[model samples]
Target chain A: MNERPIHVVGGGIAGLVAAITAAEGGAPVVLHEGGARLGGRAVGSAERPWVNLGPHVVFTDGALVRWLRQRRIDVPLCGPMVRGVRMLDDRGARFPFRQGLQLLPTILRREAPVDETFRAWAENTFGDASADLLCRLGGLITYHHDPGALSARFMWDRYRRTALSPDRVRWVAGGWVSLVDALAERARTLGVRIELDDRLTPESLPDAPTVVATKLSGAGRLLERDLSWPGARTALLDVATTADPGWPAVIADVRSDLATCCMIERETAADPAALGEEGGHLIQAQLGVAPGVGVAEGVSRIEDGLDVGFPGWREAVGWRRAQIVVDGTGAVDPPGTTWRDRPSVEQGDDVFLAGDAVAAPGFLSEVSVNSAVQAGRLALDARRRRAFAPGWPTAELTPERRLAVLAAVLPSAELTTTTVPGADEVAPVDETGPGYRIERRAGVTRATAATAGKGGVRVTRVVASALPGVARAAVERLPVWRRPFRR
Target chain B: MENQVRAAQGGDPFAMDALLTELAPWVGRLCSSIALDKGDDAMQETLISVLKNLPTLREPAAFRGWVRRIAVREALRAATGDRAIAVAEMPEVAVAPDFETAVDIRDTLTKLPPSRRAVLVLRYLEDLSEHEVAELLGTPEGTVKSGLHRARESFREHWREA
Candidate 1:
């Protein structure tokens, strides 16, 4: 309606979802991705059977599931191999982490004196002996090296979510790349124009509602503002194995420095016999590292962890690849950076924000999808309101009318009313007695109630343009406070 | 704030709007921490319930606490139903204090029942007293105390195992 296409920057899952939503809402859309391929961190290779950027999966009840269902898109997914994890120690001792409903006990039974470190809480609750074990386990699971520096409350929340309803994990039949391709195809069918390998700048951004869905650093560059947040760096390895460990797909060495190993024999599509020596099974190892650690050292540590956990791992492997990821899954949520501190969907009048870094209600990719959906919906709604009535006054209805309308719509809501100026309007209103301030600007009659309180309700009626005759008749019949229209 | 709450209770739309704006973020945070992925839904349901029953609230000053109670309950419901499921699964495994132990607080929390999680969150994160938690959860003080003790003992037993 505004003759400008809504611009969606970044081709990650968030940007793709935003572009698709806007396009489906009947708005012209353009999606820009700086990378050669979409999916950002979720990229996977056809040549590599099981290797992905990072091990990615969706929960059974995750946002992706709901989105896919809503879109009527079908993608085959294999259910989790095992509900519980396999814990490998330094001495290659394997421990069973079963999915039985009753394994975890509530750790925070007593009131903590203050917000402290995970170690402090663990020490107080489980005693010093098990406290260290808990801290290491926390670091391993969260992909952070030092759990002691993390907030106890934050850790507890994540743990509680995982424990309460441990949804079954599933992966796309093919790698994550296939899912990305499917999404792109769906987006294209919905009339979204996607431009790949085109880096965007603030000056080059189109004059339309823009949704920035890039990583935090990339988003900062496009928005021309510093949006730095604390994060973790890690080295990831993809390896092929000849023999299956006959265990759960994921085996985490909690004794190591937050090391995790995952097998993909069940997820990959490659044939075992076709491949000469190495079996069809694939394993992935991830190790969290310090900020300044060199790639060589990080890779070395990851290899060592794999060797310690699986003694004959090298003999059983065929091929391997390693790479380092910086701020892999957006910014790591540290202490003090709770949900309240995260960025919201609407950044400005015309700008919407998305990505895992945004203040959304889910974890990881779920956050990305949810935030993108919200951003897309808000952008569409804002555009609709703008295109509702053109070349007409934006009428600020009186509180009485607003109350009447609300009462009609929400019959259960108790009704009350007091006149107030519309806070969303461009023109300021005078603070006088029970009267209306009508200011006409550029063929627009902006109305404001003088007696409105600061916390008063404000309503805008587009009927002045949509149904001018009816609006005029209603205004004349209503008992407006005795006041002359101000010039 | 008190005046605003009073005005909202009296059916003042403006004050209600203001109160809603002020409370949304706090409620969102609480819900997210408790319900995780379902936080948004829980937050919306909490606000709706709160507004629907606002006229019945007697003390305007206790508005925040009242909202918190609703938020926690909504979040818990969104997370999982029937806290008894977790209580039934408590195994008598002893977890020894060893640096080599693989179990972390997360794994433990994941295995914990929902009711225990609620008690733990209210106690440590919300920093509520036992009596306050009991009252908020509509459970007796003695029950809250015993439940907490049993949960801790179960955790110690699990950790004490090799």
Candidate 2:
């Protein structure tokens, strides 16, 4: 029993994080992913470029970011750039959307009854006209199609997390797939075995403490029980545009539903090679549809909404792929099922739970990674308690072991930059060629490469003062003959 | 099916898998109806418990009944733990006609207390007689009858108000 590996079901972010953390903590682990790939719902393809199944952005100070940093995995993150988000009326007039605490004053001035539906609360507080506007905006923010079904208290809790957290939204450099790949690689390096396309059954379960990290519905099915948690259904459209939309991401009111469009090309680290020779911008449009809406109609409505938001969208679109996602996230907190009703991490003595569904601190993906960390720690603690008596010395992770883990995990990117030690100013090694500007300012060296006719920007910043050896190794690995960077 | 159960009890992995696959949906529905929102958790626990105790099941032919019994126990435990409600102290619920028209059966079931809901679900949804529901719930026949009556009355009252 002590030697049995910890079984982590699902290959999503939660499962990956749990497996990695548990393995790192000296627990043998195995991750089983039902899908062909490890990323589960958050995977991206070559055809989609930087856009994931839906528009996914990581908060800079999120638990996932901290976890990645602890593993020494370098995931380049660009800004939470203040972009234009407008609420469009039926007549096409655009009004800037207010989010987070920006609408707190308006909320405080209104009187809303406790334990009411969000729609009812909004209507009671802000009247019918304002309720419609607020509900649509809330739908956009919460990713719920029907705000009427959502709880006001739950909405308030979610709003506080979004508005109050110090963390700012930032795009992962190479889409979510890159992060997923890195996590999978890290799990493998830590001796955590991953079995893809293998579904777990009661009899087939590994002889170990198991953490069920799949979506709520999937977890329910595996356990052979019906889970009554309500979930939001969504349809996602990935569009490759010939021209930039000039905004990193935007949430717009589409009369019937709320539609969110993310300019993946602008947000992510520009990789011309990954984007291909055509060099079109990748835009992801996600529309939250009502539960009963047909998939075909939902897709059409989302496509039409995108067209309305960005006129001539059909002509500008290069490649388009549409998919309908059911139970994409975890169990949503409907009117009766608020945060308190969410399942706990400790499902049983040996069986643990993690994912967006489990009650963890924070919102959405933050809840997922946080719950995974807790679950991993719990499993590790259980393992240690079983392995040794009280006061017994446990194995600790050394710096060398940490490096070994990182080296095996970090994926090689096209652009590489290295830092120099004890140097106030460091420039690119002159091999970057013409049009590649290496600017040194305030103890930082920025190397930028761009090309004419190709509409993209690739910038790599090397923190020369820190991790000089790593930077130097990266620079040495570059080819001797460099392609002339076009300006 | 009996042969498969016997083989599963004898530690044949394939036999166990086949048996569980056949029983999973039935157990899931039973647990879901009883435990409501926490049906999945209850179902998983019930399946695990059943698997652990499979060898001890004296009569292999009684596998369905054995699994059903375990599911009911697990569902009751899940629904009542820390959030238990007394049979007599059921809260007065307002039933809107629109709610009946708009919401699904699961939504209506969720509004009732877990204990009464368990009784109602077992009696009506599972089509179990009062005595069987009583036996499954480990309560007296009178309690089961009274609980079912109260649950139905409450549901009907909500409809009446609507």
Candidate 3:
């Protein structure tokens, strides 16, 4: 019985993660997925060339990065990035928020710069035009909730990990399907048994241990009981076009509020190389439609009649679009469902529960995958402990609170720089290079200051120094490179 | 599933075409699990993904499971992150001339664990054998047999009297 394979039900992120983790940890695994294929919700269908789910971008701090890198899954990293964002108002007005050089100037007002509180910062930084754009246009796109409700911590952490880092934000070369295939291949090599259309009942799982990692409703039916989960509301849209969206990436306040939409163009004669070329496809607009944003009661309008399937450019050509809606506070687990909503890890002897919906209330492929992996680890741990005393570590993601932090701080960009003595300073002698006078400075470099651009007025303290060795003779030969110090 | 898997690997355009032709029925079945209104779009996505990635399939026998995964992924993705309208409120929109509901067994079936529920439908309802289920699932025959036994018991226990 100990040699029997560990049973994993569901092939979604969690199920796959669990299987992979278990296999990597040197345990034999048999993954049972009721579906015909694997890759749960992250990859696209056989008929669909594009991913069904909206984009699931990776963050540096995200467990996904570690999992992918550790597994040696090849993926394109870095960006199609954004530093500051612009808000579009309901009336179709546009205004940039405290962006670029303007941020430092606006920090002292009522919503002062130094305050950094979402509301105070916005009020201080944005003028009437910008404020209206943020409240209206941005509200429509992100959903209408006071930014104040968002957590500054989670938002900033994600932003810092992804946007600012040189190593964050990677898209699989073949979209998400590539990543899924690689994981599946690795699982196979590890001797993990992947069975499609093979569903699990409490009886079918190995006597060793079993973990269920399906959706909340699916898990309920398997157990013939409902588990508590918070009502979650979200929407996913996939739009395919003849060309890319105008912007590589845009997170602004638009009238049409969308949680996440990945608009892809079918491979055409235009240019296949350009697909993920500019770091990502395009920004189109600056409306980052995150799921948990603006989720308060009374902020959203209950209007319907949204039309899909029409190509914005050519009315004659039909566009392929898929939209999904989920209420974060719904009746499955229903609203007011907290930790009690989750199932006990130890379900009679060796059975345990795992899944994104089970771990916490939110929509994240990475989280779902990590939860399942953790669940598998727990299952193994339980087996080792010879106890079903809920051995696995609860995800402890702190969902809404974490999302609030993401919403509030995820958009800000922070940059740090350190200077070295040689490249950091050179005398700004008037050297005629075409029509431009390059500003060079000479000094003993102390600290590197973060600058928005490579070109600007740089300040350096004058230091007594002598040109060493042949460097002086070389400087004397190149008359165009130096100027006498003005006394 | 085998043909498409092969064509996808051999890079045969016609085999790829045949694969898409075969995908409709399976994708349609997977789409049924989701709310009906979103089925078509979700189905379209499933088919498109299956078509593009079929060639990348390393294991031909795993075709059915691969397609199933893609379809379910699309359906699940579409289910969340979209606005939900009462099913009765939205008119069913079909891209093809024929789209049918064999039975309206919504209450009992839709509620089951997606994996278990899929196995129950394919193995019992669809009359596929344990080997066939294994073939469809890309698992070994032993795992399929055990999974079926468990899924059947689970379904019977949950749906029999209720």
Please give the DockQ score of every candidate, comma-separated: 0.01, 0.01, 0.01
After TM-score superposition, the amount by which residue A219's alpha carbon in candidate 1 deviates from its true location, in angstroms, is: 1.0
Candidate 2 clashing pairs? A418-A471, A419-A464
Q: Write model 3 residue lDDT over A166-255, tens digit each, in one string.
A: 244444444566666777887888788998988766455456577787776677777667665533344333433444334213333334
In model 2, which runs have C-alpha deviations exceeding 4 angstroms? A45-50, A70-72, A91-104, A107-114, A126-128, A163-167, A245-251, A254-278, A385-487, B1-162
Q: What fraction of the true interface contacts does model 1 reproduce?
A: 0.00
> What CA root-mean-square deviation does each model show from the true structure?
28.6, 24.4, 24.6
Best by the lDDT measure? 2
Query: Candidate 2: how large is its RMSD?
Result: 24.4
Docking class of 3: incorrect
For model 2, residues A322-388, the per-residue Cα lDDT tens digits are: 7777767555677755544777778766677888877665556767787887788677766644432
Which tens-of-lDDT digit does each residue in B101-153 have in candidate 3?
A: 21224444444434444455556434578777666555577655665554465
Share of reference contacts kept by candidate 2: 0.00
Considering every candidate listed, which one attains the maximal TM-score?
1
1 or 3, greater by TM-score? 1
How many backbone clashes are present in model 2?
2
Error of 1 at A466 (Å): 43
lDDT (Cα atoms) of all candidates against the true structure: 0.59, 0.60, 0.44
Question: B124-157 in candidate 1: lDDT tens per residue?
Answer: 4456898898888777777668767755655544
Q: Chain A: TM-score in each candidate?
A: 0.71, 0.71, 0.56
